[model samples]
Target: MTWLVTGGAGYIGAHVVRALAAAGIDPVVIDDLSSGHASFVPEGVPFVEGTILDQALVEDTLRTHGVEGVIHVAGFKYAGVSVQRPLHTYEQNVEGTRVVLAAMAAAGVTNIVFSSSAAVYGTPDVPLVTEDLPKRPASPYGESKLIGEWMLRDQGVATAGSSQPLRHTSLRYFNVVGSSDTSIYDSSPHNLFPLVFEALLAGNTPKIFGDDYDTPDGTNVRDYVHVGDIAAAHVVAAQRLAAGEQVEPAYNLGSQNGLSVREIMDAMARVTGIAFEPEISPRRPGDPDRIVATGELAARDLDWANRFSVDDMVRSGWEARRAAG
Candidate 1:
């Protein structure tokens, strides 16, 4: 009853892998080492160095390892960069999901936990978004993720008549930050935390894009959830699917309360005891003013609760970044 964790060497993926291992479940991993670190993967787990687009490799890994479930987390996730390279984003996120689904169908692995994003909800009229909100993705990355969720839903329907029907759960997360351990600090230069950390390390002020939004602090507000909580939700989602729980295809993993950019910086300063300055800049395209999730559905269905506060998230990220240095 092994699980196949795509991009298991990545920041959040590594945390999921660690969570699975801590629960005494040794899942097989397939990561290309594109933006993931090889050291992030634990020693005993069997790791395959490849991409999810490699259908043959994915099928082989699934079949050989007796993988009953899959947690897909391999994809490009930079909003600004996605706008510049829409085609690359589509290929990696949308087309890559197609390959993984095809392989799962071939290997008879029906259970899946998709890593979706809250970016799919672009500039919602409501303050706290629900699962039923209209998906109006602003960037190519968000569009690709929405398409990926559609793919899973379609696949699940197509396999319904089979003896072992496909069961899928897509967790739409918002602003996934922080670290579960110091060993797997974020390596991507695109995410906000790592970018700010790098800037501060270089003795420069972290830049804040858009200081005049409609929010209270005149900055964008986001629901920042800890990586460990997100990883725990994945585990619970997998268990529910495996237990034959008749649930929807997707759930939102987010903090019910939102945090503004200024709040985040304040938390960072408080956690690290460093007075950091921020350079104000104009808003980047495709960034919504406020995007937070209710996460009530996930709590009711998957029993997912975010235990780490915003301060905890910032402190853990600071600790991990400091250790990495």
Candidate 2:
């Protein structure tokens, strides 16, 4: 069966596209290139250059490609930036998802795997977050993701009695790092891995935003999962949806184990052989003490697991970035 992957040329989306191809499923790509690279798309995969916000373009792509399902990965993903650009975030993430669902309904596409975020939970007081935790989004980006999930849920309800009822699942991701393909490195200017790599590549010290959080090492602890594992879960989710297997409305794709900024810095040094200490900057506004989740639900259903260690994660991302340079 064929599946359409929105934002398929992006770092994570590109990895998902490759995974789908490896699994013997035909894949089609639709990306606006706002934060993605066309060169990252593998040769021979059908690609359409456009935004998901365009309902006509999305519906046409789905019908033209004979797509049976859609893996929606396109969105405004920067949480901090979303705070400053709330309107843009809402437009890209919220309105964009609405349009995708509408287009799916129009094209009689019955399945979709949405790309959600951990930011939807905001800063919970608990040590390990689960799927049932209260969603208190702290930023416009987070809020937009939450609204996107709601749209999927409501759409499913609205179409429950239709001949082609919607089947959907939202995978909530934590800190996604590393690289599955050396050709497709994380290029986000806001992500941690690229920030550290760029600083070291420029012969400068990396800076930790905060090192005094109430964690084991007085630094912010986060679940850093490899991008390959993240992509693999998407592939499995697509398969389950295509087969009409039951899936939860949402699944937390987390590592369960949390790593501190200091710990990440240490791994960066060990992997890249850059032996410079990271500067400890004051915490940014609205920074949380910690945010990590358990992937038990995904592990049970999507074959999810954090297979890569901290060192491996750093090494893969570092190597990919260096290779690009």
Candidate 3:
């Protein structure tokens, strides 16, 4: 059973495709290359260049690839930037999800693994957020992701009691850093790992936003999971759905023990051998002091594990970036 991965050329999507291949599952890629690179798609894999907004293209990809399931990852992912581009975010995330579901229904693809976000729980006052938190999304991106989850829920309800009911799950995670393969790395300008690495490479010190936060080291703390672990969990979820095992509507892939910006900077310095203190900048509006969810549920079902340390994340990310050239 081949799985179609939308946005398979992007960093996280590319990693998912690789993990699927490694697990001996066949994967076909469809990427629009809006924020992804063509080179990131593994050689010999079927690559279809198209947007998830194109219902026809998505349906064709599913049919042509003999796909039984989908791992949807395509979206406008930058939360900070999403505030300035709310319309674009909704179009890409909410409308794009609707299009994908429509195509899936048309193609009779009953199973899907959605690449959801931690943004859905923006600025939660609670410590160690659980899967059942009150979703007070602060940005359009988060709201769109929540709306996407709602679409999946409504579809599942609409298709219930069928011979093959829609089996779907969404994974929400924070700070997805590190790389499983050095050939493909995070390139999002909004991500911390890439932004810091790029600044260092350009002979500029990386800046840490908001050092006055009421946390350890006076910086924001977040759950920074390894890309490999994240990909593995996605594959596990897909396998569970294929086996007809019941799954949650949403699962948080996070770390109970999170990392801080200062810790990340220290690791980057040690890994890259570029010892320079990061400049502290004012907090971005709507940025929370700390946001880390509990991965107890994922660890139980999806085999979620934080196998990489902060140093591991920094080293792998740095190696991939320097090697990309």
Candidate 4:
């Protein structure tokens, strides 16, 4: 009943830990605090301070906690930065996943819920991305996430005949926003929500990267899902794996709808009562015109849905960020 949540001190992983705990499952944490806050780990949850890249530490933690499964969420997540620091991304994501699998094999753990990314699809020309889309990762971060999924697949195949075959699933999505808990806010400097919040809090207008994309608002369109919804899906995925139920290799935790940067800016102004036009700048390279996915598979299997509206997402995240100050 005990599960290990890697990077449980981080924004997304911390929400997953809380979700698992609320579901009557014991959750253990192993976070290096590289991009995570120590205070984000709940007071009662058992936490080990270490990196997943360290096989010895990971194995020891798993054995000590009697962890039945692992929710692998630790990694370098900045897509833009990953292009500059590909080595670090691969080491933390690609090689790190391999090490986790090796440790799982050594520790006899047979289940995993991988935190994958929608970036694996690159710039999809389709209206809504599906699970079967051909992967064309545009950045090292995306490439690493795809590789991590592959490792899980190959390991599952290799262990199919064993006493404890691997039960795994990867959940992919873009633009995870909002906060499930006021105490565990998103602290990622690269995320859109936090960046706008930071600018508004500083009495500065937020800048949109570009407003010339082929969309209704001329801003790039992307999927945005609340963090609570994202965390709830992970809990369901873990439970399904634990129950020996049928599961897909990957699922997109996406909102069928897409939102533009201008829409988000409007939401921010409305929610925060900060009425200021967003400054528009030239588009950053590799910025895709549109990328959204269909969460039909996740909706059917993991009971996934976008429970929070754009205003709700903005208010909650803004409140949490302001509370952290």
Q: Which lDDT values do the candidates have, in the order given?
A: 0.88, 0.94, 0.92, 0.94
Candidate with better TM-score, 1 vs 4: 4
In order of appearance, the predictions have TM-scores of: 0.96, 0.98, 0.98, 0.99
Best by lDDT: 4
Ordered list by lDDT, greatest first: 4, 2, 3, 1
Worst 10 residues of 2 by lDDT: 282-291
For 1-325, candidate 1 gives per-residue lDDT tens digits of 6899999989999999988877666788999998898899999899999988899999999999999899999999887799999999998999999999999989989899999998888778888899999999888988999999999999888888988688998999877899989887987787788888888788888889989999999999989899999998888888888888877778888788889999998887777777977789989876778888988989988778889887899889888989987
Question: Stretches of candidate 2 above 4 Å error?
Answer: none
Candidate 3: tens digits of C-alpha lDDT, residues 1-325: 7999999999999999999999889999998999999999999999999889999999998998889899999999998899899999999999999999999999999999999998898899987999999998888999999999999999999899887678999999988999988999999988889999999999999999899988979999889999989999999999999889989999999999899999999999999999998998889877778888999999889988889989999999999999998
Model 4 misplaced stretches (Cα beyond 4 Å): none
lDDT (Cα) of model 3: 0.92
For model 4, residues 71-151, the per-residue Cα lDDT tens digits are 999999999999999999999999989999999999999999999999999888898999999999999999999999999
Q: Evaluate model 4: give its TM-score.
A: 0.99
Ranking by TM-score: 4, 2, 3, 1
Runs with alpha carbons beyond 4 Å of true place in candidate 1? none
Give a tens-digit lDDT track for model 2, residues 141-210: 9999999999999999999998999999999987899998899999999999999999999999899888
Instruction: Name the TM-score of candidate 1.
Output: 0.96
Give the higher-lDDT candidate: 2 or 3.
Answer: 2
Worst 10 residues of 1 by lDDT: 19-28
Supply candidate 3's per-residue lDDT for 274: 96
Once fitted onto the true fold, the runs of candidate 3 whose alpha carbons sit more than 4 angstroms away are none
